[model samples]
Target: MAGDAYEVLLTSTARKDLDKRLRKSPAKKDKVAKAVKRMREFGPTYPSFNTHQEKRTSRADDPTYISYVEHNTHGAWRMYWKYAQDKIVVLYIGPHP
Candidate 1:
């Protein structure tokens, strides 16, 4: 548990997508912000609080996975991330499709 904390960051594409969403809906923006904050504070372990899965890996070198978190007033939202050392790179975020 000592190394549970990780640095959370969004990919450039994810940042652009989030910016677009923030301009369209304030409520949705708030929910996403909260989720992002949780990710930073709790790191990869935060996903355990929601429904999550470790995606199948073809390469042992890659540990990419995804999680479904409850979005405020809406259905579950999906987020993809991969851990590298002490960092959690958030690759994507969007409504389940």
Candidate 2:
């Protein structure tokens, strides 16, 4: 399941970030655990299947970006993916806030 189009890639730094936060506060740990569990149950579902355009000035001249709004049990998460060659690539995951 984790090997398909959706790959949960947590680097060492990201893992450290998660561990530090979870260790520092119990609330954060609970919230993150719940979010993770929700993710496991439901891969990712968008509130709307519609596509939206975004302007990313940080990327320089090529600032045009298209994104989708996905939701989970906790809240909504923005999914930046590219639909090419009949494959969907999930870029990242995090709370909307």
The estimated TM-scores of all candidates read 0.69, 0.41
Q: Residue 70 deviation, candidate 1, in Å?
A: 1.7
**How many collisions per candidate?**
0, 0
Best lDDT among the predictions, by candidate number? 1
The per-model lDDT (C-alpha) reads 0.66, 0.42
Among all windows of ten consecutive residues in candidate 2, which has the lowest summed lDDT? 61-70
lDDT against true structure, model 1: 0.66
Candidate 2 achieves a global lDDT of 0.42
- Residue pairs clashing in model 2 are none
Superposition-based RMSD of candidate 1 using all C-alpha atoms, in angstroms: 4.2
> Which parts of model 2 are misplaced by more than 4 Å?
1-7, 46-97
